[model samples]
Structures are given as structure tokens and as C-alpha cells.
Target: MPSGPEVLQAIDWRQPWLAGWREWGEPVAQAVADGLPLHEALNHRSAAPVRFVPQAALPPGEAYERYIFNSGLCPTREGLHDFFNGLCWMRFPRIKTRLNQLQAAEIAAAGVAPLRGPVRDALTVFDENAAFLLAPPPLWEALMGKDWQALFVALRPLWPQARLVLFGHALLEKLVYPRKPITAHVYLAPPAIDTIANLDAWLAADLGADKLAGKPFVPLPVLGVPGWWPENENFSFYDDSLVFRPRR
Candidate 1:
């Protein structure tokens, strides 16, 4: 593999929100530096390997979690989406595995539904457009609403610790095909995070509301988050007046 420092320098992050990914995704660069393709790099042989099964090869939903437990990977095909998903597995194995277990357990219990159960819905939401938000409890509801002021202005002090790591490929892909109503998957971080950025190494301890101020948050339409447009300007996806507007 290329020198670790070289790996860090090569992978360009589009936004600061993804600084965690940039900092933590050194393996991606090391693999690249060593001339490893995406799939090989991701599913590299380990004590536990994540299998990249073709869509046709996958069994029913009920067996999915069992399959993951047995094989340490759920089904995924090759593509940019699959590629990013692999990166997520490498970055957040525990969280990803837990999500799979929940999903598989839900499927095993209720089977697939046209509308889906709350558990499945929550999992899907997290998988699709969610951001793994590491912030305080006071910021959870506000951050969920994408309240910029509550997060960054009035509660500016939180920025020293507030972090948002994305786990959704749809949100990542939207770096190109931008969209809205993109919610942050806020997961309250514990003190362990102050030292390392390993999502796999995270300990889920909700940081409840301490003495913090509330502020009216400015609703910022999240699109073109960062690194999408070349100009490096503060732009919003809602700028396309015809495509998006306030619902009246």
C-alpha cells in the first residue's frame, strides 16, 4: 500500500460534514495506492468477510440476517452505490451489522410489508438519507429539523464536538443528483469519540440535554452540500425555483 500519509492526502472530501469519512477512510486510499479495485479492497479476506453477492444470488429477506451472521455480509451488487455501501461496512461494521440484524429480525418476524413496519421504516430511512449525527441531545430534535442556527449559531460552542457522519448512499450520491428533505441521522456520541473517529468503535451513550440555549433555527435547504459544485460557493438545491418551492 502507499504510505499512510499519501493515502490521507489523495482522497478528496467534498464537505466538512464528511471530514470523519476523510479522516477514517484511509483504508480506501491505502487500498487504492496499492492498486486494489473497489470490490477486492472492500471484501478483502479477513477473519470476517463481507460478501458482495450478486442480486440474483440473494435468498429471501428472512434469511438475510442469518446470512450476514453466518457470512458476515449481506447481499450487494457492484456499482457506485454498492461501492459506497462497502465503504460504509468498512467504516461502521458494528452499526451496519446491527442495522442488518434489526432488519433481518423484522423481516423474519413480520415478513415483508408493502408499507413496512416502523422498525424497517426507520432502518430504511437511516440507510437512505440519514446522517450519523454526533451531537448533544438538545441538538437532536433541532438537528433533525436541519435547524442551522440552533446547531451552528446560538449553540455554536457545540461545534467543537458536534459531528455529522453520513451513512446513506443516497445522500452521498446526491452529491451529484441533489435532493431535499435530507434528514440527519443524529446519534449522540459518547466521550470516546473525543479520541478516535472509528464508527465501529463507537459506544452508544445518549448525551442528554445539559444547560444549553434554544434558538430559532434557519431552515437551510440541504443540497449541493459540499464538493459537488466546483465553484465552492454557498448554494442550495432549492435555487431551481421551478423544481422546488415552499408548499402553499
Candidate 2:
């Protein structure tokens, strides 16, 4: 797997708006243009203070929009660069529901038992700003299949400036070989495996604030088996290698 600094250095490193989508399909590209504005796309830092409506005010399908909009304003066009086709529930309902349940269960199981320091560090980054982004698992898996050229074509337009995180058993299978023999049976639905949180209680143990926010702390994929266990003998991140760097 790529080291944290190695990953960070690879990104184009621009504010959100200045990013480009090198290969979006016409319809998806048009949808983005129609839904957001240029200012909203870049320069709008989500951590800045913003008000939000209670869940009661949103229509059933739109509850997730709270994460995308800032104080009820649609994200700027540049900000939309952070949006992924998989993040929207209207586009992937089944996966969304499964992901929520899996996450809730993990937190419940880990309740207050001090998480190992590294995992805590990961969680702190996730919770501090409630940052959100999405990925396409199938596309990611395909890339691991040694189709880097095609994956680059598809993701360039969407993540023009940054190195996208790739985690999950398939990702690992494609990118990093395991230490021992493992089964091909491990896998999770895309939604359940796509998130990275720097702020979950246990995942935030010892990291300083500077390391938990912004550039250095890019998303890291955490692989889980389809039903929520490790597909192989190694299930804990503590047992896996970890790399962290100061946020830029």
C-alpha cells in the first residue's frame, strides 16, 4: 500500500474548485454543472460555521443532503468534486442502508473500550469536521485488476487533484498482498467499505490536532468482509501496517 506522505504528495493539491474532471460521462458531468455553482465548488471549506435543518424538514430521500449543502446552500461547483456517484442514496439505496447498519454496529461493539491508538487517530480525523466523500467500489476493484489505465480515465475528471484512497479486501488483493494465505470469500458491499473517519472515539486516541485535519490526513480504505468480518486470519488494523503524517 502507498505510505501516507507518498499518497499526499501524489495529489494535485489544489483548492476544491480548481480541480478538474478529466473523464466524466456527459450526463453525469451535465448533472454536476446544473446542480452547483463555481464558488460553491472550490474555496468553500465545510468546517466553516454553517446552519442545518433538522431531519424533520427534509423529504425522506433527501436526508443525506445535509452533508452536501452548507447552511442550506448547494455546494459550490468545485466542492462538487468531493461528491461521488456512490454517496447519493437516490443512486444507491440498498448499499447506503447496509453501510449505515454496519457502521452503527462497529461503533456499538467498540463502545468505550479504548481503541488502539492508531485507530483512534483515524477516527479523530473523521469526526472533527464530519467530512464526507464517496467512491465507486466496482471501479476501484477493476483498477486492482490491473486496469490502471481505464481507472485513471474514469476517475481523473472526478478526482483530478487528489490521490483517491483504496481499501477493502478487493483493494488489498489488487494493491497489497497479504502476509499469509487468505480466502477469496471476503468482501463488503461498496457502501459499507467506502468510508474513512478520523473522529470515531477509538480511532482518535493519540494524534494531535494538526495531524487530524486537512491535507495530510487523506481517506484510507478500511477493508471488511461482506457480512462484516475479516475474510482472512488478520482482522485488526493493529496487526496491519499504518502510516500517518502532519496535515498540510
Q: Against the true structure, candidate 2 has what lDDT?
A: 0.30
- Candidate 1, residue 82: the lDDT equals 53
lDDT to native, each model: 0.51, 0.30
* Candidate 1 lDDT (Cα, 0 to 1): 0.51
Worst 10 residues of 1 by lDDT: 207-216
What C-alpha lDDT, on a 0 to 100 scale, does residue 18 get in candidate 1?
57
* lDDT score for residue 62 of model 1: 39
Model 2 stretches with alpha carbons more than 4 Å out: 1-28, 35-81, 85-88, 111-248
User: 1-248 in candidate 2: lDDT tens per residue?
Assistant: 34321221232223221122222222333443555332332223122222222234445554233333323322322222223222222222333333333333344455434452444433332322222223455444533453333333444343332233222212222223323222221121223332333212222332233343322332323232112224322333223333211123
Q: Model 1, range 16-77, lDDT digits (tens) per residue?
A: 55565664455654664576654555566322236655545566653555676666655655
Model 2 earns a TM-score of: 0.23
